[model samples]
Target chain A: MTSTHDADGDLAVRTAGLTKRFRSGQVAVDGLDLAVPRGAVYGFLGPNGSGKTTTIRMLLGLAHPTAGRAWLLGSPMPDAAARVLPRVGALVEGPAFHPYLSGRANLARLDAGDATADPRTSRRRADAALDRVGLSAAATKPYRQYSLGMKQRLGLAAALLQPRDLLVLDEPTNGLDPQGTREVRHLVRELADGGATVLVSSHLLAEIEQVCTHVGIMSRGRLLLQGERAALTEREAARLAVTTRAGQADAAAEVLRGLGLADVARDGRALPGGAGTARLTAALGPTPPEKVSAALVHAGVDLVGLEVDRPSLEQVFVELTGEGFDVAR
Target chain B: MSRAEVLDGPGAGLPVAAPAPVAFARLLRSELRLVLGRRRNLVLLAGLALVPVVIGTVLLVTRDSALSGQGPAFLAQVTGNGLFLVVAALFLCLPFLLPLCIGIASGDAVAGEASAGTLRYLLVVPVPRTRLLLVKALAALTFAAAAVLAVAVTGLLVGAAFFGVQDVVLLSGSTVPVGEGVVRVAGIVAYVGLSLTGLVAVGLFFSTLTEVPVGAMAATVVVAVVSTVLDSLPQLSAIHPGLLTHHWFDFAEFLRVQVDWGVVGSGLAVQAAWVAVFGSLAWARFTTADVTS
Candidate 1:
């Protein structure tokens, strides 16, 4: 196997031209390139059937890739799966456990299945994990009796049974209520704060925006963009909205255009607040807000107000993928 | 957070400790627990135990004249030789009951996990697919052996109470000591258990072909029923030797004063061949098949 370590070993996950195609000839993941830097809370954002789960599966060695190579923790996957997987904890897609076994017993069995875990300490660790996930009261309940939220918590508890170098959670808060979602979000922040690299996948832009340090947006089995959260949001062009005196709306537009700003639009009528106020919006490309303010003042246009409308992540995501946000895929 | 606290937290600058490698023995133990701990399986076993009791009671209450000429040859001798009860019960169960239970267990080995959405988790444990398949097959075989033993033990206890143990009479017209007769009965029970190895392989192969446990179970039992049906058609004589159920009854040879090694050996060889063919097929399908669930 090839060594996965880069110069500084800063990447927790790396893939070069990774691809997977089902037997029916449907391409699930198409030559995907992904990089998750170490110590970063990377949110893998994608729609349903967008290949997020498939990519995660291949990285974990649960599904064989039809093309390309991937590495986890600086080790080439599958070839090094046995040696590398012990330090990686994952909760993929949804929770799955034996219906007959209690939550504690299920975790104990999963822990015992790990070659690196000491069986003697497994019971205590299982109990600790349950407590960490706030499922201590239901630890003895059979898994079948668990509600959807409880089952999701048990899945999280299983992933926390050991001290892991990385945590890969796919749609972790799926099927969770508002309170449950908040608890999971808080726990994710705590885990990341405690220093484990986490790769969490979700289609919720608001959720990703709140907790992720870096983000990768995927659509139609392809990654559209990946970068630091601040950098990505910074890349979007902020709109300049100018509220001018009633008769000066056309003058403000002409001034904005004369300043070499393209895509400038003048409202047909004055602002609803008063007959003297009119709003003109212009797309600011690389021009500072001070330039627009100075140009309007020099052009003798009465500027009632001027504000820079920075694009939200949701708008940026929609612009990047050419698809609507807010709807669950 | 304090720098000192950050340093003590998980994955913070501290080297991550690798978990202890899972032993093959532990995997086996876990597999056994998973297969045997189900309430459904326990109930199936209880039902199997009841078969012997019902058969023994019927034979014990009936008059000698009423049963002398009825049912299997072993049934006629159940009142005379108590050990025959064990052999008689095995004979009655082998054709369907034993194979049915084995089919249900083996068929659910992989498909059940897939349907429950647990197969993905198991594979991610880094348990090599081939090793997981082997473990599952072994668990199914263990169930088959245990099922046969349950019936045999139940039959022995019930038969010993209904009819006193005595020396055995062979189909060859020779008499053996009681100890030897008990040993022969054990050999027959073991042989019957071995006879189901082919069915276990068949069930496992079907299991790998689908994600629905019920579909796999029905398909596996159907395969056995079809094989038996084909075995009964003398017109298919050319293929009779190849059928899985053709040599199922060859264990009867163990009842003779001098065992027919030729027939017994051939039976075992056929079962082994079936195991090899179907076992390889299961491994091939499982290792290459994508787990979407």
Candidate 2:
């Protein structure tokens, strides 16, 4: 992991030891360290009750973190936010559009420093963004007429009105159905590909797993894990499942001991059953596949089948958080 | 540089170029848009339009001989009655309503966005909280000016159209010509603008304190109502002039023939003082607020 203050393209966002404690003494965010590279779609993933929203607020200078510092687009928190803010666009929390205004007008009002952008230009941008988010037909409709998924899309269009370098979206697909979810996912990918550093925080682990190149899991006011998806998976041990003959179970176990290949355990228990008419699982911690196979053959174990299992990010998350994972809807 | 040269120097462009005409102005402009862009703002404007027509119709239908003693002619009655009624409308009715409007206008000024979740969006734009409050307060001031202007202009035109010209008599027994009365009324209109600053500041302060737009607006109005009631007390005459609620109605006294700058000036001073105090509180609160909905 490259740890540096100044990254590139204005460094997008940086926070060090950021902490926020509510007046009621509940620590919302504690000792958080976040660094988002410019133009990289950084997905912020955490279970509910995590400090995702708090961290987002602190980064935007919306809420003052109790301790530590934050920098956005190279400016310090609350101090340099004005100069840095115009260049960034964001959609935080609920879709709070003026219910009376049309979808297009709502985005028009939110567009910063676009006062000189010809009304026609604004209209075109609003229309295009709305269309991109699959809300083109709903442009003229009142915001109150919009459904939750539609509102989420409208909020996104509002955020994308001006070509901002960074997008801070909180649960962008919160109320979206499968189709709406796909649209947002595609939009996020395209935004990152277009060189905009995207920070999307959500409780949806599956969404983060599918699209995020870099992931940060926050839990209980702390950042539990953050890294490239592949690297975190690589750190875990590889497992192989095998079935054997019952007659040579004990003899195979002795042969495996002679060959020093009997270190594999079943269900985390000591290797009690040998090559019986039973299934056996083995662990290979960062070892080459060829070596494991050779050790099995040399031990004369009746190997019926050998298959390598790749653990999903979901499994790793469940193991790390010590909770039942939510089945992604 | 001499003060004269500084005054005469390139309007806003100076030797060093002053920082963005008024940081508060842009903030104010945005805040104004927040108010004006809403449908409720148009409704408020429409409501103000009816004041002149409604008051005019009532006078036409009633044509009471009793009202003639209150004022001599149509313009006198209209402008005279209009000034007081407008003051009542702006100060009393609006305190209860407009502050709420302003409170609603600005109520969500920060919190609305926070609650709606757009506050973070605005903040991420890196707008300083001070700038945000300044802009929002300024916007409310503009609307305050607009609300007062709406009543003054509409009421005067309707009064003139229906009643014709009438010499205005001040409380001091000095007579002001119809034309001069118009000018003074304009001045009074301007004064109303200044007077409203205190109320707007109060609304702005409440705006900073809460995320609920209605709550902020209602609180300012409640405070205004309570203060107005206290100021109206017969025993508090000595201290009444100091309360902003007392000064908001002082404009009617401007209709007097020999303009009493003493009372007017004091009223203006008191209102300005309230503005400074509330404005400071708003500034401090906004600058230090966490603003997380």
Candidate 3:
């Protein structure tokens, strides 16, 4: 993260050493410095136990941090919360609403709470938002009767009640069917195209990988990486896979180990050469393929085939946090 | 409204979203609807309204029996003129039922939203924590006033039906026309409503301390119960005047021929003190609270 010395109007969300320590002495978010550029689809990626929601809450002034400060839309919070929050829309920790209130009434109620929302246009705008989320049919159904997907759509409608410049959505696609998830992805892109900076948090990389312009990876209460999506994934080296006799797989691993590959390991994947074949996978790092092949042959390990594969963001996450994510479904 | 006009820092020199009065009125109206429109809350108010009807029915049926003059003084007071039933019912409900109704309504003020998980959304709507608290407290207070009037108005109707409305006899032995008597009944309702504001504040403060509405409701009712219990102990007379329920029954002074404004003023003063202390405490706890739920 860049130093927060410059007050960049280009940045929509900025936090400096933002931390949250609960009364029980557990640190939920540790010294997080977030810089989300204007109009970018920023994905905040973290596992379930990570503090993604906590960080989002702190940013939105719903949760107070124990130390440090934050600014939203170029003003300090929560001193500026009354002034700034009206311009930003958010959906955090999934959908919550009055059980007895209908989906339309719920959106209308939320719009009424927005100072910037014109009371005369509130019902119209709420209906429009419901249409936008494809929940118009169930608009009059009581919230308690909504299916999980419908409830999520209402939450999105509430967040879109006013034309906001920034949208902070935490796991917006949660509880969505594949069709609904696709719609959410499409809607996000549509919103991003409309010039609103979208800060979306998710544990699934593939969910955001398609549309995210920038990505911030967080694990165990700390930010591990933050930058343009291309650069983050490009920084990870390609993987080297070697196929050989099952008996020589350990020797090929030893050879790759000798070549300074920290991730050298045997693969459980099926190999081309019938019964006795085996595969070994390792990070290619800076090593040349010829040296790997020569080392394997020099060690009497016959190389049937060798291939170099580009690393996935999942591998990048594993490399950084030493823990795997529940892959995107 | 334009986004740029939605006001930011004071130094922005931009137009605010709307006039302060307009925004506050809108917010307060919305809160009142949310609080009073709920079916459960309507049930609570209806329950209070029925108390007077039940009392009036019992007294009307037993007036011919030896049971007359056997119950509380207000019960006997109802026989002479039905207008006194308003006073009788208000007096009967004050100790437990009135506080319980308000407790259920006001106790759920903040905690209800928290438990429903809507508190975070409201706060982030940028309603300003202090303003949100003000709206919640006002909504609950409105519910409280409604609860008081429910019993009084219903009592008046049942009294008129049972014993027939007539001129009221003051405790000091002066007679007043039925119209004047109703005016005093209104006065009693207003005073009873004022007496409960302190409890409203207490409920709000407790509401902010937890996410469980039932817990807040119980705590609020318990506070009233304990205060009433303590007020009855002669040995604790030193703290009687300062207790929440101390001045509750003092609304009887409103029934006097020449109202003692001093006693009325002191009762209101006690309520004001409680509101001031508890209101500020609620604001303090709520404004700085982290809305994790």
- Relative to the true structure, how large is the alpha-carbon lDDT of every model? 0.85, 0.68, 0.87
Which stretches of model 3 miss by more than 4 angstroms?
A1-6, A239-308, A326-329, B1-16
Number of backbone-clashing residue pairs for each candidate, in the order shown: 8, 13, 0
List, residue by residue over A186-274, the lDDT tens digit for candidate 1: 98899999988899998776765688899998887888889898788879777888998878888889989988887898766646659
Candidate 2, B48-89: lDDT as tens digits: 767667766766666666664343222334544444334333
Tell me candidate 3's fraction of native contacts, as a decimal between 0 and 1: 0.65
- Residue A30 deviation, candidate 3, in Å? 1.3
Candidate number of the best lDDT: 3
**Poorly placed runs, candidate 2 (over 4 Å):** A1-13, A37-40, A73-75, A113-121, A242-280, A287-307, A325-329, B1-31, B64-111, B172-174, B234-238
Residues forming the 10-long window of minimal summed lDDT in candidate 1 chain B:
B11-20
**Residue A199 lDDT in candidate 1:** 93
Query: Which of 1 and 3 is the better model by DockQ?
Result: 3
Candidate 3 lDDT, B130-213, residue by residue in tens: 888998999999999999989988988899888898888888888899888888888998999999999999999999999999
**Per-candidate interface DockQ score:** 0.30, 0.26, 0.35
Please identify which of the two predictions, 1 or 3, would achieve the higher lDDT against the true structure: 3
Each prediction's TM-score versus the true structure: 0.88, 0.81, 0.87
> Looking at model 1 chain A, which ten-residue stretch has the lowest summed lDDT?
A1-10
